[model samples]
Structures are given as C-alpha cells and as structure tokens.
Target: MKQRNILISGLSLVLMTSVSSVAMAQCTATGTAAGFAPQYAPFAVGGALNTLVSSINAANTAFLTQSTAFVGSPANPKPDQEGGGIWARGIGGEINTKNTVSSTYALGGNGSTFQPVATPLTGGVNCNTTTNLQFAGTQVGTDMARLNWNGWNVHMGSMAGYLGARARDTTAATPGINAGGSLSNSLEVPFVGAYAAATYGSFFIDGQIRWDFYQNTINDPIQNGLFNQKIDARGLAFTANAGYNFQLGNNWFIEPSAGIVISQVKVDPLRATGTLLLTGAGSIPNTTTFSNIESYLARLSVRVGTTIVSDKMIWQPFVTASVYHDFAGAAKAAYSESNNPAFEALSFPLIQGNLTANNLGTYGQFALGIAGQVAGTGWLGYLRADYRTGDRIEGYSLNGGLRYQFTPDML
Candidate 1:
C-alpha cells in the first residue's frame, strides 16, 4: 500500500511539470512572433508601445512647425493641418504671358528748296529769270504691338509689333514764267516686327526682327505737260539685347541695357511723262531711270526704369535713349537721263535732286513710359511717349495698350 501511494504521487508531480513546460514554450513563441525578447517578452512589448507613441508625437510637432512658417507666423499654435506654403513660394515675383496692342499717330512739317534758271539774251533785248522756293511737309504714322512683359519679378513672354509713316507736300512747285506748272510728292512706309524675351535673377535677354516697306510718288506739270514718278523700297532689321536691373528703395529700380540692331535697305526709282503718250504712243516715254540702292545700318539703345506693386495692381515707369550709325549703301544721283525723243524736245528742267551717300546721317531719340497690372486681376497695360531728333528727321510719338492673362502658367 506504501509503494502504490508513492507511485501515484510521482505521476501527479510529472503531469504538473509537463503542463508548466508547455505554457512556457507557448509564451516564448508568442514573444518571437511579436518581435520581442523571449526572456522579457512583457517588458519588451511595453517599451515598443511607448516608442511608437513618441515617434507619432515627433512627427506631429514637425508638421506644426512647417505650417507656422508658411503663414508668416513663427510662434503660432497649430491650427487645422492645412497646406499653405505652396502659394507663398513665389510671392514677391510677377509672371506675365498676355499680349498687348497699341497705336500712335504723329504729324510734322518743315522743308526748304532752291532753283536755278537759264534764259535767252539778244543785243538791246535781254530776258532773265531766277526762282527760289519754300515748302512744308505733313508726317503721320501708326504704331502697334502684340505683347509686353514688364513686372517687378521674373517673367517669360513674346511680342509682335509694327510702325508705319506717311508724308505729303502740296505747296512744292516748278519755276518759269510760261512754265505754269505744279509739283508734289508723297511717301508711305510700313514696318512689322516680332520679339521674344526671358528674365531670371535681375537679368534678361531678348531678340527681335522687323521688315519695312516704302512707296513714293511724285507728280509735276510743266508747259501744259504732265510727269509722274514712282519708287519702291524694302528693308529688314534685327536686334539682340541683354539687360540688368538694380533695385533701389522706395519702390524704385533702374535698368540699363545694351543692344545691337542691324538693318538692310533697297530702293528702286522710275519716271514717265504723259504728253508723249498722246502722239501715236500707248506707253508714256521715260525721262530718267535711277539705279537701285542698298544700305546697311547699325543702332544701339539704353533704358532705365522703376516699378511699384500692391495687392491687385502694379506700376512701372521707364526712360530710354537710342542712337544709330550712318547707313552704308548705294549713293543717290542728282540727275538721270533717257533716250526718249519727246523728253529731249520739251527740255524739262531738273526737278528734285537725289540724296547723296555723304548725306546719310545719324539720329538719336528719347522715350518714356509706364507699364503695370490692372486692379483685381492679372491684366496688364501701359502708356508711353517719345521724342526723336537727328540730322535727317525729328518728331514726337505716343502710344498705349492693354493685355489680359490667359494661362496660369504664363504668370
């Protein structure tokens, strides 16, 4: 009976020990699955939970700091976690992509003329004649442009523009007692141009090209006869420029630029008479034919300016000075001739003389303007005036235009 009791007790002890071992194994497996140390599973799990909370807190703090920096506020408490920094990245700069169109008209009059004469003389009967003349000319022009990107900040854009001129003289006349006659001349010139420019860090570069066309007509009547003349001319010009801006206090800035303009021109002249056409002639006889001429010219310019900006508006005022070199081309002739017999019989005297190579002169000009954005929108506008003085011509010009922004990426 003592041996039976001892065996039973031993079996009970083994069963209890096996159950405890299984429970310990299960705990070790769970610890490994949860990525914790097996000997200190509970403590390791608690430490990991605390670490995760700390990581989340740090992230929240960083986000708050960035948010505060964006709103021009450094010490403000965290509000709703909203994205506000994107719009502040380029706040002080301006970008323009719209087009601007403008037109201008001008008129001026000032000219002089002189005449030489020949007469017949006989013994005790002599006749002599001499004449001098004065006249005035009216000048008119139209100027237009497609775009202008002028702002306080960086920008990229393109422009297309044109300028045209017309001049006429009504008081010009020919001389002689029996030479009851009248003479007049008219001229028209047109130009078209296009350009592109980009700006970065107070610096900008631009390139442009232009084409010009000119037409001229002259009418003169002498001794009951009529004369007509026509001339056609064409020109091409190009410019490349680089500029820098200096910022001054009080909403002011100054920009100076240097540029080179190259131009080429060609001219053709023709003349005819009407009296010869009536005498068995369908074509009016030609009295003179002037040789065609070509010219190459160079020019330079500089500009200075400033700008002011508010929430919904911007304003800029600028001034520019420019000069051009003498032209290099064929010389104008004082007189020309033809073999038509009717021209020889009437002996029509020389009319207006031609411009010589030495007569080609240099010119300079000054211009001022203002450009800015409209209130409450991205629209742009400008007003400008200019005065030009030179050896060849002098005049004043005025222009204005507006543009509307069509794309966000353009600004």
Candidate 2:
C-alpha cells in the first residue's frame, strides 16, 4: 500500500510540472510577438494583426527592391520562422548612388591648305598679280577645365579660360613682273576664352566668349615699287551665344545655336617708303602710318553629331555664319591722305586701302570638326579640330585643353 501511494504522488507532481512548463512557453511566445509589434508597428494593433502583417511585408519588399536598384545588395536582417523579415537597418542618412566628378586636359595642333578663285582685274593691264595660291600652317597649344556633380540627371558648369597661340602663313606666286613677285603673309594671334552651359534631360543651353590679339605682316611689292609692308593690328572681341542641344536616340545629339560677336579692331599700316616723288622728296620723307577699327559682328551656328563609344567622347560637326560692320575712321584717313596737298601735287597713285564703314553687310562661315575627352579625372579635358570659312577668312583650327574642377556645386 505504501509503494502504491508514493508512485501516485510522484506522477501527480510530474503532471503538474509538465502543465506549468507548457503555460510558461505560451506566455513567452506571446510576449515576444507583443514586443516586436509595439516597437516596429505601433499602429498595427487590434483585430487587424493579419492585415498589418501583410502591409509590413509589402513595404519591406518594396524598400529592398528600390535599394537593390542602386547598389546591388541584399536586405538587412534575417527573416523570422514565419518567412517575414524585419528591417534592422535605418533608412536615415543613406545615399543610393555616389556622385561623380570628372576633369580633363588636352593639347593638339591644327592646320589646313586651300586654294580659292582669284579676283580678276578688268583692263588686263600689266599690273602683275597672281591667283589660285595655296597657304597652310598650324596652331599649337593646350586647354584645361573641370566637370563635377553630374548625378541629378543634369550637367551644369562654366568651361572657360583657355590660353593658346594661332600662327598662320600664306604664300602666293604671280608672274608678269620683272621678277615673279612672290607674296608671303604670316599672322600670330593669341586667344583667351570661356564658356558656360547647363543641361536638363535631352536639352542643353550654352554660351561662350573669346578675346584675340592679332599681329600680321605681308611681304609683297607691286611691280617692285611698294616694297614690303608690315601691319601691326590689335583687337578685342566678345561673343554671346545661346544654344539648345537635342538628344536623338542613344549616343546622338544635335545642337543649334545663335550668337552675336562684337569686336573692336585696330590696324596700323606702315609704308616701306617715305619720300613723295611728286611732292619733291623733302615734302614727304619715309614711313607712312594708317590705322582703322572694326566694331560689330554677328553669327549663327548649327552642330550635329554624337558621342563615340562612351559618354565621355563626343564628336560634333558644325557650320557657322558671321557678319561684320567695318568702322569708318581708317577709311576716312586713307581718303584724306590720297587727296592731300603733297599727294595731289606729286600724283602718287594710291595702291591698297582699308577703312571702317557701316556699309559692310553679312558674311558666312562653315565649320566641321570633332571634340572629345582625352585623359583626366573629369570631362574638362577636350580635343577639337575644325575647319571654318567666311568673308576674307578661311582656315582650320585645332584646340585641346585640360581643366581643373574647383567649385562643382554652385547655386
């Protein structure tokens, strides 16, 4: 009887302990669910627990989808046994993509050779001149700049301030004179310029200005009478431009621009001889000086092309038309000198003359070229080559440069 009672008591005790353990386990699970819900989803309570759970799961999936689009990575925190994961990482202060800054610098030489129809003289006098001559030379130098913060699907910056030299020489041969007169002219011009632009979506607008100081000399004599004449010229020009760039498909874009250039030019011509034979030698000695100025210019341009292989490499072929209004002071001076008392008595014929006047009308220019990136941390470095033609001027220019990015972020 005693053994039976002991076994029964022990079994009762074991039963009670098992029941207590089950109850404790259930309480612990409920507590864990409550804690997670209150902290992560405070408003997701009441009888809508199932709906809340579904909504939370959808939001988590959406966040992961968006995050992976930028930096291929998995969502933080492991999923629970029920297959729903809680977002353990905070979305605060996180960047989806890193901003990029690019800078570039390039150097190159440009040259060209051409022959145009010569201007024919009417009376066919033995004036002795040449036609259909060829001329060519190169411009050597480097350009530099910088580009930055191009991440917002837009690009904006000022690519300006490049310094370089353009040296050109032309030679023409003419027969009929005692000795075939060969005329050679050379010019050296230094230029400094700047440009600014902004791009949004498929459209871009830009403007630029450049200043050139020119010095040129021509060594030619008409029938060995004029000797060699040297011209010292100085000028300042400002160009204002506005353009729109249109994107065509992938890697192709076309930009058409219109602008005006106002230029101030001064040309001083020095004669090789001083004495005026008609005025009796002593009246006029040697060295005659003539000066003139040109002040207004306007232009329009259209560029079409695309990038090669990469977004950093661009090739744009363009055509431009420009016109200038000649200033009058120089022309008036030349006329005065021709009708002077000494010149009239000596009967010295006027040879070549230039003057400033408003009657000068429109001129045209056509250019074709390619510009692209070379080497650098930014897109500021560029290499460009172009051929341009207009009234009294036709030639090819090559430009390359390096740019350093200073303030990429500007209001």
Compose the digit string of candidate 2's lDDT tens values, residues 26-133. Answer: 011122122222111111111111111111111111111111000000111122201111111111111010011111111111111111123211110111111111
Number of clashes in model 2? Answer: 24
| Prediction 1 TM-score vs. true | 0.48
Per-residue CA lDDT of model 1 for 304-353, tens digit only, reads 55555556555666676766554554333322223344443444222222
Which residue window of length 10 is worst by lDDT in model 2?
A: 15-24
* CA deviation > 4 Å runs, candidate 1: 1-164, 169-194, 222-230, 274-300, 327-331, 341-360, 408-410
**Which stretches of model 2 miss by more than 4 angstroms?**
1-183, 191-212, 221-231, 274-291, 308-368, 374-376, 379-385, 388-411
Global lDDT of each model?
0.31, 0.27
Number of the top-ranking candidate, with TM-score as the measure? 1
Clashes of each: 2, 24
Q: Highest lDDT among the candidates is held by which one?
A: 1
